[model samples]
Target: MRFTSHTTSADGITERDFVHDGVPGVLWTPGHDPAGLVLSAHGGGRHKRAPGILARAHRCAAAGLAVVALDAPGHGDRVRTAEDERFAIEIRSRMAAGQDAGALVAEYNALQASRAIPEWRSVLDALPALGDRVGFWGVSMGSALGIPLVAAEPRVRAAVFGLIGATGPLVRAAAAITVPVRFLLQCDDRLVARDAGLALFDAFAAPRKSLHANPGGHGDVPEHELAGAVTFLAG
Candidate 1:
C-alpha cells in the first residue's frame, strides 16, 4: 500500500488516501490506537467517500476503530470496462421498461467480487497497522461482495450486511460465514423483494445474527440503525 495524502481533522481523526495494486482507498483512524479495524464497502455506483460511508467511518473512528474503504472496480477513479458499460446500459433499459433486473445485478456483482476480494485480501496483507480484530460493513452491492469475502476470510470476526437478497451463490456464501452478523433491511426496497432479503438473512450460519428492518426504500436506512451498527462493530 502506498499512501498518497494524509490529514487530521479537528476532532482528532486522521484520514489517509492510498493506492494498493492500482486500487484507490481511504483510511480513517482515531488519534489513539484503534481497538479494532473495520473494512467498509460502498454501494454500487458510489465511491469510497460517499456521504454515508464517510459518516460511518467518522463515527467508527470516534469510537476508536480504524476504518478503511476502497473504490470498487468500475467506480470512482477506476476505469470501467466494456462489460461494465454494457451492464450499466442493460440495467437502465430493464428498469425503464419495468422489467426485473435482479439477475443482471447478481451476475454483475459476482464478477465484481471475483476482482474485489483479492484486492481486499492484498490490502489486508499490507495493512499490518490493523490489530487482531477485523470486521466488515457493507450493504446492497457491498453485501453481494462482502458475504463471499467474510465467508472465505477467517480474519474477519464480525460483519454488517444487508440490502441484498438470496441469490444462489450469495446464499451458499452466507452459509459458510459463521461470524456474528448485523443485517439491515429496508422493508419496502423496490429492488429487493422483502421475502428474498429475509431468506438471505436466514441463510447465514452465524449463531449470533440480528435483522433490522425499517420502513423505507433502498436508500432510506433509518438513522438509528447506522448508530447501532457503529456500536455493534465497535464492540
Candidate 2:
C-alpha cells in the first residue's frame, strides 16, 4: 500500500491517498490513536470523494475515528466498461419511464458487490493499522455492496446502511449480517421502492438494529441525519 499523496488539513486531520493492487482509496486520520475505523462506500454515480462521503469521513476523523473510502467498481478511478455504461443508460431510461427498475438495479449491484467485497477484504488485509473495532458506512449502491461485505467480514462491528432493497442475492446476504446496524430509510425514495427497503430492514439478522426513517425522497437525507450517522459510526 504505497501512499500517492499525504496532506494535513488546518484542523489537524491528515488525508492520505493510496492504491493497493490497483484499488484507489483515501484515508482520513485524526493524527491521534484512533478508537475505531470506518470503511465507507459510495452510491452509484458517486466516487470515493463525493461530498456526502467526504463529509462523513471528515466528521468521523474529527471524532478520533480513522475513516477510509474506496471507489466501487466502475466508479471513481476504476475503468468503466461498456456494460457499466449501458447499465447507467438503462437506469435513467427506466426511471424516466416510471418503471420498476429495482430488479435491474439489484442485479447490477450484485455483480458489482462480487468484485467490491473481495476488494474491501483486501483493503483490510493491506491496512492492519485501521484498528480492531471496525464499522461500515454505505448508501444506495454502497449499501447493496456493503450488506454482503458486513455479512462476510467479522471485522466489521457495526454498520450504517440502507437505501437499497432485498431484490437479488442480497435477500440471502442480509440474513447473515448480525452486526449492529443503523439503517437509514427515506420515506419517499424515488430510486428505491419503499416496501423493498422496509423489507430489507426486516431481513437483517442483527441482534441490535434500528430503522431511521426520514420524510423525503431519495438523495434528500437531511444534514442533521448525517450528523446522527457520524455519531452512530463513532460509537
Candidate 3:
C-alpha cells in the first residue's frame, strides 16, 4: 500500500545516515534549529514513514522544532540483511513466535532489555547539538525509547508521548524525569489502552502535565497535544 506524504515545510526533509558510537540509523530532519531537537522512534512493525510519522515531524519542524525520526535497527532503512535474506531468516523465526500485538510487545520488551536506550544516549553523545533544548515526541516504541533517555539526560526540556502512557519500561523510568510532559489518547484504542496511559500519567512526578483524549481511534493524534507541549517546554 502506498502512503501519502508531502514536503511543504520551509525546511524540507533531509535523509542521511548518522552513525555514532557504533549505532547507525537513518535521520529525517524536518528543518528547524539544530540545537533544539525532537527524536522519534516508531511503533513495532513500523518505520519512520509509518502513517503519521513524517508529516507530524514536518509540522513540528514548521512549528520551530527540529525533528529527528529514526528507524529501529531492523525496520525501514535499518533492516539488517537484504530484504530477501533478512526476512527469510528473522521473519520466519520471529513469526513462529506469534505475529501480533503480543509479539510486538515482546519485541519491544527485548529491545529495552538489550539496552536500546543507552544506544540513543550514545547518539546524543555523538551529536553534541542533539543534546540541547531537546523535547521528545515518540509514538509507541518511540515513547519507550524517549522515557529513559529523557530521564537519564537533563537536556530534554519537555516531551509529548503519542499513543503511549505511564506503563511499560518507558513509564517505569518516567519518575526519573523532572521535566514537563504530555500524553495523547484515543478512548477506543487498542494499541496502547487509554486506561494504561492514565495510570502512567498519574505516576509521573512532573509538577505540570496532563492527558488529552482525541476524538479518534488509535494512531496519530492531532495538534492540541503539540500546543500543550509548547506551553510546557516554553515555561
Q: Regarding lDDT, does 1 or 2 come out ahead? A: 1
Give each model's whole-structure lDDT: 0.95, 0.89, 0.62
Give all TM-scores, in the order shown.
0.99, 0.97, 0.73
Candidate 1 stretches with Cα past 4 Å from truth are: none
Q: Least accurate stretch of 10 residues (summed lDDT) in model 3?
A: 1-10
Q: What is candidate 3's lDDT per residue for 1-235, written digit by digit as tens?
A: 1112333434465556554544455454545454466666666567767766766665555565556566665667654545435434564576576553444453544464355667666665655654377777775667666677777778677877656655456566777777888876777666666777788777677887777788666754656665565455434
| Full candidate order by TM-score, most accurate first | 1, 2, 3
TM-score of 1: 0.99
Candidate ranking under lDDT, highest first, comes to 1, 2, 3
The pairs that clash in candidate 3 are 166-200
Please estimate how well model 2 matches the true structure, expressed as its whole-model Cα lDDT.
0.89
lDDT of 2 by residue, 25-128 (tens): 99999978888999999998999899988888999999999988998889999999898999899988998898877777887898899989999999988878
Model 1: per-residue Cα lDDT at residue 127? 80
